[model samples]
Target chain A: MKLTILGCYSATPRTDTNPTSQVLEINNHMFLIDCGEGTQVELRRNKIKFARIKHIFISHLHGDHFFGLVGLISTFRLLTRETELHIYCPKGLKEVITLQMKLADSWTNYQLIFHELTSTESELIFEDDKVQVFTIPLDHRVYTNGFLFKEKAGDRHLDMDAVLNANINVAYYRKLKQGYDVVNEDGVLIDNNKVTTDPNPPKSYAFCSDTAYNEAIIPIIKGVDVLYHESTFLDQHASLAPKTKHSTAKEAATIAKKAKVKTLVLGHFSTRYDNLNDFKSEAQTVFESVELADDGKTFNFD
Target chain B: MKLTILGCYSATPRTDTNPTSQVLEINNHMFLIDCGEGTQVELRRNKIKFARIKHIFISHLHGDHFFGLVGLISTFRLLTRETELHIYCPKGLKEVITLQMKLADSWTNYQLIFHELTSTESELIFEDDKVQVFTIPLDHRVYTNGFLFKEKAGDRHLDMDAVLNANINVAYYRKLKQGYDVVNEDGVLIDNNKVTTDPNPPKSYAFCSDTAYNEAIIPIIKGVDVLYHESTFLDQHASLAPKTKHSTAKEAATIAKKAKVKTLVLGHFSTRYDNLNDFKSEAQTVFESVELADDGKTFNFD
Candidate 1:
């Protein structure tokens, strides 16, 4: 799995810092998350192909979170994209986008599908053979949802030498990989464990942003391989976190520690703080594994 | 008068080139023209203060022309701006912007006033003591209007020595600057020309973009000091100009020559061309004075 941070700063895009936008490449799927203003330019700057973004997930209706959505949609139409694009966002986003498109009179030639999420409970929103995505309900000023992307375990690897030694027919190899015992060519029953090894462990990533210090999401994102949480403020501005429905660095680290995530990626930093290392040091005080997210940063998980 | 080109490309914004947006500073007023995506960042790159932009003029409803307005508006709110912002755009833009704000539940603390223009004829959209802005209706796929920023003639320069020689009272200085024949301190009628010289000729700038090769706007922008016109294609792709409701570099030059504009500034270049000098050369063929508009390029008319 590969994750690219197109933008990570908060509260309006600046010349050097972008608001919020990321690209996650998992199991041949490139998912765009929280397209803030200037996100399209950031994507271009990062050299991410626009066509690869088949699914877009917006956390909330905040301008910093999803203002670039309409521009991206319009760009897709201008590029004459033919593939269907899916948008998973809050309830009212569809109306907003539709109205803009209606006013511009530039409808997309491709299928533009909107999956509005209004449920307060955590639920599965998307699933395929190799990947599953669920909504992690978050507490924010508006109706918001973070997304959890989990990869499904692959089939077991075949022990070629062991299978040949056991005189297992090639047709029975499929059953062996499926964790089943099958009859060999000699009509002898063979154990699956003897011919095949276990598959690689699946990985999971959780993205949560623009939320207060709510423990309710810790359960949903528990034990995630990588957890990207918004740390819009530091200890000095802790009082403003709750009032603004944002999380401080220590608060995000606490949530990551409680959730037992393998890695905590801190992002959505407020532009007021000039030193991002402060957030890293603060988060590390509570969580041992903490990484700072900056614009154009990339992380690869194996 | 100073004009800063934040973005001057056509269609979708890319990593290096922006779609359409510029800042025109005339007579102390900073007017934003055609705010495309990433305009706020461009504004920052250009070192333009957000508070100085009190008015924004959008050429049309095309995504490339005004996609950045909403984000800029939202940023102003985040910055706690209390000044009133006036937006002059085509009809239906207000609904589009209002709906997005409603969905986000982020109403601006500053008053956002929209002047929706549905006029097909050239009309005055904004006026002040120092500057006057008029719409130059252009033919395009959608309803569009270019803007003409004309600096009002300044007070006449007083011939200090001549004023003293004529024995004009100091109290009549204001009247003398206004080109009135005021009575001198000795009760002698003074000729206005004898004491004061004519004011500097008012500078005018016409911005026409995303338009076809229509001569209808020639009369509206005729003999302007500077004319920034859309030149989306070179002569190689001249055939596609009218079909796409755009103009070629040669066509823009032709219009500039016919309108007797002092300097023709070509912009809104298609991303297909790698060399921008070709646009300048192509335009210079028909017009003697041709300047190319580029991102981050600034033009000053003194």
Candidate 2:
């Protein structure tokens, strides 16, 4: 799995910095997350294959988070995209997008589907054979949800040396790889482990942003492989963090530590500070595997 | 009167060129003509005071024409603007803006007045002490209206030399500037013409964009001091002009000539062409006074 940060600033878009948006590539699928203003240009700059992004996940209605949605959708229409696009966002997004289309008298030619998320409980929103997506309720001024993308366990791989030593029939090799016992014409039970080894460990990535420090979500994201939690402020502004319903770097790190996440990625830095290293240092106090997300930066998980 | 071209390119937003949007400063009022994507950032780059914008006039609902409206409005709310804003656009624009506000639950604290235009006949939309705005019926697939900003016949400027020579009382000077034949306190009759001259010949700017070569608008914008018309294509692609409800350089210049406009400013260029000089040379053949619009370029009328 690989994750690319297209934008990771808070508040407004600047000439140098951008707002929150990212792309995660997992299981040969591209998923766009939280498209902010200027996101399409960022996608162009990053050379992301925009047409392959079949799914979009929005965190909230804040302009810094999803203002670029209308333009992106319109650009897709202009490109004459044939594939259907799916959006998982709060219920209000559909109304906003349709209104813009109505006024312009322009609608996407391709099928556009919206999965309105209004639930507070952790619920599965998207699922396929390779991956599953669930919502992690967040505490914010408005209705918002975070997404957890977890890859499903795969089939075991065959150990060729063991298989050859066992003299497994070539016709029964497929069954051994599937972790099933196969019997020959002699009517003998063949051990599945003799020819097969365990599949590679599954991976998971979680995205949480524009939320206050809440302990309830720790259990939901327990042992996550990678956690991207918003760090809007440094430890000095921890007093104002709770009032704004935003998290500080230390607070995000606390959540990551409690959740036992392997990697903690911090993003959505507020415009108040000029330096970003403070966030990294603060987050490292609680979690060592901490990294800051910068625009056009990509992280690969193998 | 001063006009600033915020963006003039047609089609999608790119790295360098911009879509249609401009700011016309007439009688010390900043009236934003059209707002395409990334206009607010352009406004910032141009050093335009955001609070001074009291009115916005949109010619059509095309994405390139007014996709930046919602973002501008939201930014105003964030900046804590208290003055009421007036948006004059097509009939369906209000629905789009209001629906976006409803979904985000972030309605402006300031008053948002909308003057929806749906009439085919010329009609007055906005009138102030210094400016009177009227719509010119346009031909397009959608219901579009071009706007004409005419400076009202101003209060006559007092010829200071004549005022001092006539020995007019200081209190009566205000009456003389109002074009009144003021009788001196000493019971002397003073001719209004002798003391004052006609206030700077009521400058007018006509904006005609996203329309085919429609001659009916000539009478409405007749003798305009300056006409800004969209030259989306060159004469080489004139065949595609009418189908898209756009105009070529020659066509725009022809309309300016038929209307007897003083000067012609060509803009809304299609991104297909790299050389902009072709438009200037082509339009000059039909109209002698022609200027090209570029992003961040300003034109002043004296």
Candidate 3:
């Protein structure tokens, strides 16, 4: 799995810092998250192909979270894209985007699908043979949701020498990989474990942003291989966190620690802070494994 | 008058080249025109303060022309701006912008007034004591209008030496500046022309973009001091101009020459051409004085 941070700063986009937007590549799917203003330029700067973004997920209706969405859709139309695009966002976002398109009189030639999320409980939103996506309801000033992407385990690997020694027929190989015992060519029943080994362990990633300190999400994101949480403020501005419905570095670290995530990535930093290292140090005081997210940064997980 | 080009390229914005957006400063007023995506960041990069801009003029509803407007308004709200902002745009933009704000529940603290233009004829849209802005209707794929900003002629210069020689009283100086014949202290009538010269010829700038090769706007923009016109194509792609409702470089110069504009500035070049100098050479074939618009380039007219 590979994750690329197109932008990580908070509030309005500036010349040096961008707002919240990122790309996650998992199991041949490239998912765009929280496209803030200037996100298209950032994507171009990062050399990410626009054709690869088939699905986009918006956390909320905040301007900093999803203002770039319409521009991106318009660009897709200008490029004459033929691939269908899917958008998963809050219920009201569809109206906002469709209205803009209606005014421009520039409708997309490709199919545009919107998946509005209104459920307050954690539920599976998407599932395929190799991947599953679930929504983690978050507490914010508006209706918001974070997404959790998990990879499904693959089929067991066949022990070729052991299978040949057991005189297993070629047709039975498929059932053996499915962890099923089958009769060999000699008409003898064979154990599945003796001919195949276990598959690699699956990995999971959780993304949460623009939310207050809430323990309710800890269980939903528990034991995630990587957890990206928003830390908009540091310790000095801790008082503003609750008032603004944002999280401080220490609060994000506490959630990361409680969830027992293998790696914690901190992002969505407020532009007021001059030093990003301060957030890293503050988060590390509570959580041992903490990483800072900056614009154009990339992380790879095996 | 000082004009700053924030973005001048056509089509979608890229990492190095931006779409259409510019800042025009005339007679102490800063006017933002055609805010494409990433315009707010471009404004910051150019060091133009947000508070100085009270008016925005959008030529059309195309995504490259006005997509950044809502984000800029939302940023103003985040900045706690209390100054009123006025927007002049096509008829459908108000509904499109207000709906996004309503969905996000993020209304601006400042008053946002919209002046929807639907006239096919040239009309005055804004005027104050020192400046007047008129719409130069143009033909495009959508309803479009260019803006003509003309600085109202200032009061005639005092010509202090001539006034004092005529023994004019301090109380009559205001009348003298208004080009009135005023009685001097000795009760003698003094001629206005003898005391004062004509104020610097009122400068005018016409901005026409995203339009076809229509001669209807020639009369409205005739004899303007500077004219910024869209040249989306080169001579090689002249055939695509009418089909796309865009203008070629030579076509733009032809309009400039026929209108007798002092200087013609070509912008909105298609990204396919790598050399911008070719546009300048192509335009010079029809008009003697021509300039190319580039991102971050500024032009000052005295």
Candidate 4:
């Protein structure tokens, strides 16, 4: 699995800094999360193929999170895209986008579908053979949901030497990989565990941003391989953090430690601070594995 | 008068090229015209003072012309701006912008005013003591208008030598500048024309973009100091010009020549052409003193 940070700042987008947006690639699926302003330009700068983004997930209706969505959709239309696009966002987003399209009198040539989300409970939003996505209800001023992407468990790996010793026929390899016991050529019963070992463990990633420090989501995102949490401010501005429905670096680290995630990535920094090293230092006090996410940064997990 | 080209291209904004937007500074007023997507970032890159941009003029409801407006307004609010902002555009723009603001639940602290324009005739849209702006009705896919900024005639310059020779009192100098024949101490009737020359000739700039070859506006913008006309295509694709409601380079030059403007600026070139010099060469065939408008290029008129 790989993740690319298209933008990782909070509030307004500056010349050097962008707002919240990222791309997560797992199980051959490229899922776009929280398209901020100027995301299309960032996608081009990063050389990511625009057509690969079939599904876009918006956390909220704030300008910083979903303002770029309409432009991106318009660009896709301009590019003469034929593939259908899916948008999973709050209920109000459909009206906002369709109104602009009506004004311009320019509708997409491709099919455009919208999945409006309104549930406050943690629910599974999407599932396929290879991956599953669930919503992590977050604490924020507005209705917001953080997405968790988990790879589905695969079939068992066959041990070639053990299968050869068991005198298993080559035609029965598929059954062994499927973890089923089969009879050998001599009518001897062979156990599946003797010829096959377990497959690699599935990995999962959780993305949470523009939210306050809430312990309620920790149980849902527990034991994730990587957790991206918003750390908009440092401890010095701790008083302003909760008031603004944001989290400080120390608070994010505390959540990471309590959730027992394998790795923690702190991002969505406030533009007021100039130094970013302090965020990592503060997060490291509680979480041993901490990384800082910046614009154009990419993280890889195996 | 100083004009800064923030973006000068047609249709969608790309990584290297931007859509239509410019900043015209005349008579100590900074007027932002046609804010396209990514315009706020371009303004920051140009190092323009955000507080000075009190008025924004949108040409049409097309996303390329006014998509960046809401983001800019939101940024002002985030910056704690208390200054009022004025937006002048087509009739439908107010509803589109206000709807987004309502959905976000974040209203500006400052007063936001909207002036919707629906006239098909050339009419005065804005005016002050020092400058006046009129709408140059344009032909396009939607209801669009190009802006014409003109500096009002200033106070007559006082010829100090001529004034003293006429024995005019210092207190009455103001009357002379106002073009009044004042009574001298010697009771001699002195002509005001003999003492003062005409103030710098009133300079005007006409911006006509995203329009087809329409000669009806030639009489309105006749003999202006500078004329910016859109040349979205070359002679090779002249057939596509009228169908798209755009103009060719030759068509733009023909208008400039017929209007007898002092200088002509050709911009809004389509992305299909790789070489821009062809546009200049093609335009010069019909008119002289043709300049190209490019992103970040500034033109100063004295």
The lDDT for every candidate, in the order shown, is 0.93, 0.90, 0.94, 0.92
Q: Worst ten-residue run, lDDT, model 3 chain B?
A: B96-105
Model 3 per-residue lDDT tens digits across residues B1-302: 99999999987989999989999999999999999999999999999999999999999998999989999999999999999999999999999888888878889999999999999889999999999999999889889999999999999998989988999999998888888999988889999999998888899999999899999999999999999999999989999999999999999999999999999999999999899999999999999899999999999987
Q: Alpha-carbon error at B143 in model 4, in Å?
A: 1.0
Q: Across the candidates, what are chain A's individual TM-scores?
A: 0.98, 0.97, 0.97, 0.96
Tell how far residue B63 is off in model 2, in angstroms.
2.1
Per-residue error for A4 in candidate 1, Å, reads 0.8
Q: Ranking under TM-score, best-scoring first?
A: 1, 3, 4, 2
Report chain B TM per candidate: 0.99, 0.97, 0.99, 0.97
TM-score against native, each model: 0.99, 0.93, 0.98, 0.97
| Tens digits of per-residue lDDT for model 4, B1-302 | 99999999987787888888999999899999998888999999999999999999998888888888889999999999999999989998888888989988999999999999999999998899999999999999999898899999988999999999989889889998889989888988889999998988888999998899999989989999999999999999999999999999999999999999999999999988899999999999999889999999999998
* DockQ (CA atoms), all models: 0.83, 0.52, 0.85, 0.76
In model 1, the clashing pairs are none
**Number of the predicted model whose TM-score against the real structure is largest:** 1
In terms of TM-score, how similar is model 1 to the real structure? 0.99
Clashing pairs in 4: none
Tell me the TM-score that candidate 2 gets on chain A alone.
Answer: 0.97
Per residue, candidate 1 scores C-alpha lDDT tens digits across B1-302 of: 89999999988998889989999998899999999998998998989999999999999998999989999999999999999999999999998889888888889999999999999999999998999999999989989999999999999999999999999889999999998999988899999998899899999999999899999888999999999999999999989988989999999999999999999999999999999999999888788899999999999998
Candidate that beats the other on TM-score, 3 or 4, i.e. the better one: 3
Report the Cα interface RMSD of each model, rounded to 1 decimal: 1.0, 1.5, 0.9, 0.9
